[model samples]
Target: MSTDLSSTPPGSPGAPASDKLDRHVLVIAGVVVLGAIMSILDITVVSVALETFQREFDATTAQVAWTMTAYTLALASVIPLTGWASDRFGTKRLYLIAIVLFSAGSALCAAATSLEMLVAFRVVQGLGGGMLVPLGMTILTRAAGPERLGRVMAVMGVPMLLGPIFGPILGGALIDNASWHWIFLINVPIGVATIVYAAIVLPKDDVEPSETFDWLGMVLLSPGLAAFLYGVSTIPETGTILDAEVLVPAIIGLLLIAAFVPWALSRRNAHPLVDLRLFQNFTLTIAVIAMALFAMAFFGASLLFPLYFQQVRGEGALDAGLLLAPQGLGAMLVMPLAGVLTDRIGPGKIVLVGVAVITVGMGMFATLDAETSYYFLTGALFVMGLGMGATMMPIMTAALQTLRGHTVARGSTLLNIVQQVAASIGTAIFSVLLTNGVKNEADPTALALGEIEDESQLRAFLEQTGIPAEQLPTILRDLTDDLAGVFSGTFWIAAAMVAVVLVPAFFLPRKPPAEPVDQTALMGH
Candidate 1:
């Protein structure tokens, strides 16, 4: 049963002739990429604006933080329903509706007069924003079919990888020159345009209204994810996972997620909101695990980089963001080549090489000091970007290659969920480590300076510490050195974390078949 090479998709063995995506597939991919960029950029852009929001709204740090927290919670809550919604409403229609909702939320956010109102509107935006990426992946998967998934994912990954790199720079520019409201308002036109274009060109897949909605699964999974993420988000602020604020919700969320697995597995005919059975595929399972580890390492290191630039190097937000651009540029340069190579050589070997590169990049970062050259840092970051660009999309493509038909949507959602959780855990763990490292090395007197706002209070604190006013500069210098050392150690931890990916990468299939094998035939379709 030999399959025609021309008919086979790109990832499958035996079909070199069908490697290039059709023009129609390219157009669809372009549209999906547009929405993905808009949504992901929106997430990262708001991060740089948080301080501005706090001051403008006259709110406490915790209160102003809710602007982001609420949005994240909403996103976590809604992601589980995306698979069912896509099936019930059709991918094209649901995608259009999501855009409209996101645009409406953006408009409302721009018009918000109070922090509370802004937080409310952000939740609305999250509802729509959460659906866009998964649905976009689902749509692209079906359109490109299994064979071309690697190339299609590479295209879609452009915004996902670049959004964080450029988001802060854009946000800083907007805040410095214009009002913060523009951050939310900017999404309006993009969303509207995407909606209109998607409505016109997107294929209308048949709606499966008969597909049973797993209400129990939703109740269990959505809140579980939200609570877990919320707890993790609190770690930077609370300083420890043992805090009641972190522990209670995280435990409950874990219990709920654990419960959902068996409940979902026990279901007979109806599909769970996210199918656990997909984990049965060894390749998909390993890919998912690799992705989770990669997310933790990548995101944790990403957080540390900006803070090191800002706090230790004394750079502003925009400068730090620009400095981060080399990594993204590196990723951009390599992604197309990585995609093509993954198709030809299989993902396992590419991933092994990519992870090795990333580990080397992290090792470079781990050796940084306050006086590290800008050129060296830039080159290292670019290498990290190259490694990430080569690694992430291929892992995603590998997972998708193993899925077919209805399973694709659930698989996308599952991957997104794991990524979100992994990033949160990474952020939480690294944040705690950084905080403790700085505290352990910092001078007690210098640390107390942070709390002394008034000149009189500062003098009183200095007198209490029995330090002369003239010696403050020396203490500050020592403090900077300590911070640099702490950040350097943190990068080492990130490197070690990234090294863990090699274990799972080895599990990925080493080579593609020389001849095209019909994916449908292999899957017993």
Candidate 2:
């Protein structure tokens, strides 16, 4: 009797029994991590460069902001296509293509001469970057197998967690010492190395017959998601969700997204662009909900961390980034242990504890004042990092552990898209709240002074306006304290949202499945 090795799922009775990741899997992980670092890091890296772009291009803040916004919108637009493309072209081939496309886009972005040109180039870069993370997850998950997923996922989570912390430090160093162009130029060499390494070290694709492409669903979802995210991205600038720029596109996007649900569920469309049918898995659904809430609360509030340092504490970009390092350090210390624990016991208990820890950390931030000690703030960040290390990857392991065969690709895609959307919404909501709060707290005269970028600028304004020198200390003290209060209030909301993640986390699987996952049962094949 002959057995089909290719047909066997990892962790199945007939498949390899070892729970540890071997050298081959480790090498594959290296390749995936390299690509993931580039993709995730780009999002935060450009955030610090916005002011530089504004100066270089002589553009308004809103126009310069498009450098980030365009990339985000383009990234969201292309993600739905990844699952189907992965299946059709194979992960290995598609991965290489994504790397090449991203590298080319990066090169073009560095060479851009105008704001318009840069925005167009960012769209190209985003299209390429869009596929990297989901595809990396799919590759690593299949390579490491279900039994070793927690460890491997912990490895993957490093980039996701550290990107925000390190991006500013790196971006600031490069722009301060080198120039803004180096930010994009730096990726060129890394991308080249990643492409070559991936082509050689990555396994060959095992292609299957392709399904018919879902053109109709693509029309409804991609544009819909892009429009919605664009509106949300503008919220910080618009200051309200009710503005025409925010509302018109958001409502239209929602209508289109609403239409997609039924179209995806229709029997006539055998292959939807994004398979909503996957949500039918009870475990998968709950895990995704928990992930969405965690991401919304954590990522949304994280953007404020550096802003608080720069605006209120009078720190430079690099200094703010360095101060935030404790959070990343905390996450690093616990991620590996969290991974192993998830493998031994299911993700439920681990994630519940993680959310609670995060709630505590955020609560600490809610009480922050301009005079709060650095030691106290860093300590709180470290505690939050511990929770994050335990939370994100374990939640992911829970979501993908039960998925078998082809569902792995689609599942990863779904998770990435949900994370992106949730983070965007959270950012917009928190930003609007903080902006409104600041408006209410400051006196009208202080508000009219506009943003004071530095002490020199503030000094110049005070001297020119003939304000009394005696009142300088009072003015600075009140401004900083009020700004700190706005931040503290916003974090209170973040704490509450983090706590809400507990509801879905409670429903996650508590123990590893006794039987190897049944692919047919989950997929209804």
Candidate 3:
């Protein structure tokens, strides 16, 4: 960022500041933005289509659901290596190639005729897709310099905010009017254009970064997290906790992940995939942990909301997506202000407030009912969005606050990995909870109401459960409403977690005294 060319040889570091204000900034930014949008959308877009995948493949809920987990796992596996890859290659080259790869994966998914093929291709998409978000942050922050980062983040966060909203909406519309294939197909034009634009506008950095890939670390970390998540996903699948097959894989995964710590810490300059040493930076450590937990809570609940609207409230997919739009809009509205405030006040204080509001929002949702008002449900969503808006930038700033220059790239990449892994855990954990409660409660409600008379007995016997008789009449209508509350409980727990995380704020060094802004990186503004 310091335009002083003495330190960085042109070919070694990433794309240096362009000589003039080339259209390349916009080009790279556009590609990065689209990449970010695609990656974010992928996480949620498939939720609506899960049933379709199940029906078409003749798969059970467990089998079809892997479509989501596979993508997430692939993402977690590859994310830690992003910074090293970019540094070794070149940011612009790596970013462009990543987009193309992601698009190709999307195309593969669209062309797939079978369930197995689709899941495999989704993993490919995840591999490339995971690069966009963290790489986007690294590029933007470096591009903007310290002076303009607040505004840059505010502007950039718009697409990031909209991803969750559009995923369901887009999925719903595509499934309704077109078909599931369109969800993946839509990325092609965007990807092609991003590649072309990048080639033209992005500066050519012939950086030959020489470094070794952390094959050993990857061997342990990726499979470890995958096993843990896969095991968690299975709890819901088998509808029981005692499955030894699931338990063994999961426990092994946990042990492997635990082993990665000492393995990574021992590597001095050779960052084995990820540098766990970044945790020593208090600001980044707290930010990553809080965000990881927040994502776990947020994404875990997101899966259930659509199900609630469709299954319990009897709304269509598109309608539910539309209904959910207001919340995202609220987050979009508030994020810019939060960005500005983050710069004026410290990120620590700003994030604290954001986390508090988020907790309140989650608590509000915790009190849902079968006949709650749309305003009540949507309003709670809006508050949660506000929390996301308020929290995202400040928290990002906190992560970057202490890491000066290119070190921020490594921090950003590691931060991204943390959130992805945390989110999968969140989904798996909440899904397991939802499955258990629903399975345990379904039959009792029927029996108590004398609904399982004789033929119904066959269904009960097969289900191996009973529903309370008085609740049997409305059980189908109320299942999602009850599930929503169960998921909300996870949010409340995350909110309470903010208190513990806040303690680390004391250590963030006050904005380095009289810090000079990095003007070369600030060319866009």
Candidate 4:
């Protein structure tokens, strides 16, 4: 039986009452999309501005990086609290509060006088931003009902996917035309409008009877996730997982997380922090497995795209961001159709096709070299985008469709945690691979260029390395070609991971259930 009674039954749990999303649901989706845009865009926009922050604060690379890391750590720590908080306090009230916190944090960030102050403000921003996605999913899922979940999710997916592609372009334009503060300041007005819109438009959700707070699970999971992600985030900079900075926290984090699993599985805690019980749904379990594989392979390889444009082709940050637009365009073109097809046939058939398309696109990237044509590269990206638009949201729909009542919130939260963790691990793994590749191929002169910030340091660094100054031009040219090979090889690895997603995807529900399964009945097993 369905637990959430917010919306009247359409036709059946698995079938839509109507083919189109009604006006009320559309309004709710709009509010969710607005909040999502602010949260998702901030991650990438701030990333593009890291160099600017470094120069402005006169900080070392490691110190400046904390601006990004602190935000991420804060995000990982707070996400576990969202599903519980939404159930304890109503979703609308919590949604508005999150906006206020995010907005206030953004304002404080803009006014910060030092790097430490900026990092502190970012933590506040992260706490608010972390809740937006899962909460948004809960709000939309409850309002749209199961029949239209795919389409509404597709609408939400647009900003989620586009944020990474467009954030750098927006960040670069603002940095060049304005100042670094604009990135943070940009969120203020949007946040204000979202608050007002949500306050007026979103239907009030009743707070469910609160369950006993999972204090032990929170202690185990929050720090475990924060410590784990902090370590993973450092891997790209440290260039190896073996480093003390990476190993110590990562190992400790893993052990703590391992402890959390059994504790959550125990029968004593009726309401666990993350609700691992939802995995009892076979369709949801397979969907998340496929999602993890896809996220690792696709998002991991995506990190290299801008680097390829900027470092190898020598495009400016703005130009590199612009060059990647075709991928976003391709995703936009296909997502709505994919959503429709998922609602009709089931996510299984569509996902298999999506994975195949992504593999083809990735295969094209795997062959890349320094002299590869831009037309061919853009075409490949467009093809991949089409696949991505089809793939990501459908997987989410597959995980969420069967769960009833509060289980919807639990399912969304679990799906998000898996995606975030998988993407982080994948990024770290691929980054280390590429870094090693470049290091192995480059000589002392090539490595020195990365270390030297100014002309004064260049001569001294060359003297220290004992490389002839006369060969600099030739070394730069050769290093560029070497970088291309390293990236190509890494893309091949990413392509293989994408292919692995198919194994789990093969088990996703092949057709929408003629009737919704009783999720309550499955929870006992």
Candidate 5:
């Protein structure tokens, strides 16, 4: 409720004056961004190698999936405690510990002989990876202060935006040229370098621990988030939210979260794990809501592009990854400019423009077919990227700019938590939509394909479907049109989700912060 700008120093430790950009700030930002990118890139990189892990360990699909599942759950579980841990230990110390933990986990994952061991190691990796992003954001925000937050976030957003696009490409290259182990092993050098750099450059802040740990809040919120995420993750496999696999954990998680609310609000004796009261700030409230909705649309739609390239276009993983590059490129091109614009005019109008651009891109995707031109598809993706570059970091900077220095860490944690949950929900919802669309279209497609007669035409259909020539007559049928229809339908749904953000975007602040503080002040300088 209080702005209290004068209580803290001008910027974080080693931070420059509020009006200046200096070497120290850039170096610190670079190191933080590198650490964050390593963590995020690891998430998508492992996704591409799941099958490789299964084959190497001689494990079933369900068992091998734990490699990813465990990591996600661990991430969810540890995130709620990040604010407390940072305050208790100091951000620099905690970040270094996280790097060490992640590096060790990666080494163990590479050396693991069994699937179970691999999954366990992934948990360690996840715990460390989970802390990197929110904590990194907190550190960067403190260093940049409100005035320069938009530009600072632009730098930080690069890895966050590009990692998912590039992860599959890197994973495929490693898998084809080397072994699955290389996927995990690759993190070591990056992690070590990040640790060394951070240790040398990152300033040690004075620790201001809360009077007591909020054990009760943690007990409720941690599992609540994990359960909800776990349930959401199962939706693609279960095919519906109503399925017990999705319902049970989700219901329990929601109940626990519901229970935590009253408890946190009542606990005046100690700080809650996350200050739910931050929502009382209207700007912060709108920013969080807009961000959650954007995550659902963005993460959900991300799944569709790769699948479209692989299934409809019959491209391999690496090829599909290459095809998805334009989206990231478009985003990269527009982000720096977007950052400056956001600082000048505020995030509201910028986000509206972004949402509009994304809608156009998604609309184009909805019309895609087997014969759709490569240039058109890439152009649409590029437009979507430009929109995303404008939208994501601006919204984030807006949220952090609204918070007081003491609450920034908790605010960052809350934002990350919402995003993780929203992404899961988005992924689940889109997956179901695509799956159902495919199922509905399959029979009609089979009937149409039954009419194929020309030998060359039938051979081409077989190649596209990846079915045997012998089975083409009785068992296999070309579903190219059907898939195109299904993907297009799903793309429309994604577009619609993105469009919904415009309503909330209008509620954001109309201009930049009225009075900005010194960046170094957040470090208790």
Candidate 6:
């Protein structure tokens, strides 16, 4: 992996780009898409399967959460370095290797019998998975060039746009009909096929051996990011910020990132892990910030929604996925139009409208209670889907509008790193809030009146509190109805976070694209 890798020539690895590429390009695109599909599915597939995992492993919620956290942390940490890896190793080589690694990790995860081993396997998968998106973008950039970027991105968005939707559905179906292990087993064949195909098709770019890497920058940047992400993921979401589990690591991580900023900025020349100077481009900086906030707010809802549907509202996994499908479908419906809108009207107006719509959708969700009808929830999800579709593509397109071909992949990688980090943090924050909300909403009076102390005792008391022994079940139903108010408060917090995204959105430049910037320049020391 440390070997010096110069890029291949501009043409196909073994033949002319014009003729050799047509068939080969499809193979390359399939491989790239395959890689992305594997990663994307894992992100959401775990949602439905988490219950199965807990039952099989006899785990607690906090322990099980690590399964999700482990993969995301590893993925977020490695995304920053993808540009350098691709530049050094070439896209085809890196893509094939990543796929094989991911497939191997998938098999290991399926076979794991212990919680620790499963989490560790996911980390391996994440490391390989992290490299796929950027390299996939690189493959497209190399094969299609800027003229075809719009069409290429639009087509490529299919898997990314649908990953969240399909993941839950697949997980639900597999877990219900077969076993949780199948969720992972599904990736194996796809990865192997992709590896074989990419080895044959992906174009190799001419590598300039003259480019120097900032080794010091990577050392500082990677750990700082990993620590920050780990800390964010560990926020004992049910506890307060000052809770030892939440505050200690978070403070340490924050300090590290604080240290990273000054360290990177001081490096005056050569490649940096993240080129700090890229922020000098106002739109690019704004775009990056937008992506972070977008991820934080959006992914936050993702955690809450499923839980609300399944645990609170009592829907099954497949039903939850079916319920959530509107969001993905709506995004797919609007993506192409978003591409055209960005090309025509600039990102500002589109983003403003999208943000507004998302706020409205989330706001409606905030109003939900345990009693809120499922029909209303579905409507809100669709609106969220629309708003998400309307602007994110435009923002991503706008972010890279000024970047060069080779640099586009790198810039996108940086954007993805920030977005993933924000997502992990967002999930953590939401978890904390949800836990607090549930605890707070549990009536102190009811708790005091009941003689039970532990959760089991409280559950038993609540089960028969008002009962003439035979009527206990009916009384418990009444208690559940009364608890509706508590869940609504959780919705309020979720809505508030979504609304907060509007703040950063106000400053997005309405201006058109100027000169195209070099994407590689953003990789800083």
lDDT of 3: 0.70
TM-score of 2: 0.95
Which runs of model 5 end up more than 4 angstroms from their true locations?
A: 1-20, 267-269, 444-477, 516-525
Off by over 4 Å in 6: 1-30, 141-151, 444-483, 503-514, 518-525
Quick one: ranking by lDDT, best first?
2, 4, 1, 5, 6, 3
Residues 1-525, candidate 6, lDDT per residue (tens digit)? 111112324453322233222554566567677788888888888877776778889999878888988888788778878877777777777787788889999999999999999999999999999888877876775665443343345556667767877789989888888888999998898888877777766665566563467676677677777777766767754366666766676677677667667665675645556656667767778888887888887776677777777655767779878888888887888767764454444567778788888888888887877678878988898898888876565666666665765566667787777777787777777778776765666554443433344777656665665534565455445445544555566667666776666666666655544446654454432
Give Cα distance to truth, residue 431, candidate 2, Å: 0.4
What's the number of clashes in each of the models?
6, 0, 13, 1, 9, 9
Poorest stretch of ten by lDDT in candidate 3: 516-525
> Model-by-model lDDT, in order?
0.85, 0.88, 0.70, 0.88, 0.84, 0.71
Q: Which of the two, 3 or 4, has more TM-score?
A: 4
Candidate number with greatest lDDT: 2
Angstrom error of the Cα, residue 47, model 5: value is 1.1
* lDDT per residue as tens, model 5, 335-423: 99887777666788889998899999999989998779999999999999999899989999888886656578888999999988898
lDDT of 3 by residue, 447-482 (tens): 333333477665665455543445444764455555
Overall local distance difference test of candidate 4: 0.88
RMSD per prediction, one decimal? 3.2, 4.0, 6.8, 3.4, 5.6, 6.9
Please estimate how well model 1 matches the true structure, expressed as its whole-model Cα lDDT: 0.85
CA displacement after TM-score superposition, residue 122 of candidate 6 (Å)? 1.4
Residue-wise C-alpha lDDT for candidate 4, range 33-62, written one tens digit per residue: 999999989998987898898889998889
**TM-scores vs. true structure, each candidate:** 0.94, 0.95, 0.83, 0.95, 0.90, 0.85
**Of candidates 4 and 1, the better by TM-score:** 4
